[model samples]
Structures are given as structure tokens and as C-alpha cells.
Target: MRHIQRIHINVKSFICPNCAKSFKDNDTLQTHIKYIHECERNFCCRECEKTFVSSSDLNRHTQMVHMNLRRFLCSTCGKTFHTSSNAKRHFDEVCGKKEKKNGNS
Candidate 1:
């Protein structure tokens, strides 16, 4: 058997002074400040009181709940979906759906 040497370590170094918060990564600490205390919830849902950081999320929620509009239709199966990607996925994986020549399915 080989002999091994032990080492001592001191790893409690990075601390946030403003909130007495500590993180292993500085980017996490900055994200906490920007997201939690900056009052920058840019995306607000129209159907409910939910808030998000991106507008795409709010638009998705609005399309799902408030508008209830389905723009995607399967050509062979005659199934309707809210988003084009979902419709395409169903056509490829689900059943009986074919893509039109114009790719409108």
C-alpha cells in the first residue's frame, strides 16, 4: 500500500455584503440580485397574475388560456393544435397525419 498525505482547506470566502448571502459562483449571486430585488418582471400574463422574465412565456400562456385559438391542423388526422410545432410533432409521431405539399399540415 502507498502512503497518502492529507491537506487542510478553507473554502468559506465569497459572501454578499448587501444580503448576507453566499454562493459558490458569482454569477448566481448577481442573478439573485437582478431577478429578486430589481423589480424587473418583464413578462406579465393577461389571463392570470403569473409573471415571467420572458415575453414568449406570456404569449404562450395567453394563447393557451385567453385566446384559445388553434392555428395548426393535421392534414390526415384532422386534429387541431394551438401551435405549429405541436401539430408537426403530432403529424410525425402520433398517427394518420400527413404534411401537405405547401407544408401547411
Candidate 2:
């Protein structure tokens, strides 16, 4: 004899009253409200008209275009990477003989 259990997953939904746009994630919905309805462009690029939500994102964009530096480097294969995690991923995929996080070899 076996008992079967049914699991129900609740899908979260959000509705934007101002713009009539809906989203599943609260963070995205908040961002939409702040940027679209309020028109609050707090994060502005010094060199261009592009704006972002955080300073770290703007810093990364500046480093990528203005500094022209590849911060991450693969020690195993001597290959340059843009970010440290990407370097680790390349090492794992190429030399360490490990499958990617997606589990596809």
C-alpha cells in the first residue's frame, strides 16, 4: 500500500495599477513602478544617458568600456575572463573535467 501526496505550488502575481503591467517578482514590479510611473532616474551615467538601478552595475559598465581591463583570468588554461566566476566556470568545464551547473556534459 502506498499513499500519494499532491503538492501545490502557488504562483505569485502582481498588478501595477498605474501602468496596467503585471509581474511575478516583487523586485521587478517595484523597479517598474520607480522607473516608469515615478520617472525617478537616480542612477545616471556620467558619459551617456543610460541609467541603472545601482552604482555597482554602473561601475561594471564603466570598467568594461572605459578601463578596458579583464579582471578575471583562468589559471588552469591561461585564458582571460571578464568575471571571476566565469573564470572558475571555464576552468571546471575545460580542464577540471567537471560538468556545468546545468548538468549537460
Candidate 3:
């Protein structure tokens, strides 16, 4: 016969005072406060003068639209896409085998 012991631990959560939103971590709650509650748009695009909350978003926008960087390439058709989601959508809707619905092929 074997004996087993179980232990319970409590996790501390960070809560937003303004909207009463709760997060498991403090950094995520701080980021949400800075971006959503503060409405900060510090990052700006040089090409179109658009603003963004973060630098990564600005860089992605510039690469996708201005620099025309299509990093996601489809293996079946060799087609390029700006984002991975777009490439996956193309593969699922066009290249991959799909099931027919309501007698429509």
C-alpha cells in the first residue's frame, strides 16, 4: 500500500482599479493599464504617420505594408504572405482538402 499527500497553493492576482479587470501576473496588468487605460500611442510610423501602442506593432506594419516583406511562404503553391495567419487561411481554404457542406462542392 502507498500513501499520497496533496498540497494547495494560492496565487496572487493583479487587479485593475479602473475597470476591475484581474490578471494572474503583474506585468500583464501593468501593460494593459499603460496601453488601454492610459491610451498611449508613443510609437509612430515614418511612412504614413500612423501611431501604435507598441514598437513591435509599428515594425510589423512597416514590414507588411511599406517594406513589402512576405515572410510566410506556402509550400504547395509557393505563394508568399505578410503574416502566418494569412498563409494558414490560404492553405486551409484553397490548398488543403475541405469537406463539402449542404451538397455544395
- TM-score, cand. 2 vs. native: 0.51
Could you give the C-alpha RMSD of every candidate to the true structure, in order shown? 11.1, 7.8, 7.3
For model 2 the local lDDT of residue 51 reads: 85
Model 3 TM-score, 2 decimals: 0.60
TM-score to native of every candidate shown: 0.46, 0.51, 0.60
Cα lDDT, model 1, residue 52: 75
Which residue runs of candidate 2 sit more than 4 Å off their true CA positions? 1-10, 15-28, 35-39, 98-105
For residues 1-105, what per-residue lDDT tens digits would candidate 1 score against the true structure?
111211133333446667777655566777777766674777888668799777887887888778997888887778899988899889777663334544665
Per-residue lDDT for 39 in model 3? 83
lDDT of 3 by residue, 1-105 (tens): 111211133343578988988775677789889889998799999999999988999999999999999999988779999999999999788766433433334
| Steric collisions counted per model | 0, 0, 0
- Candidate with the greatest TM-score versus the true structure: 3
Best by lDDT: 3
Q: Whose TM-score is higher: candidate 2's or candidate 3's?
A: 3
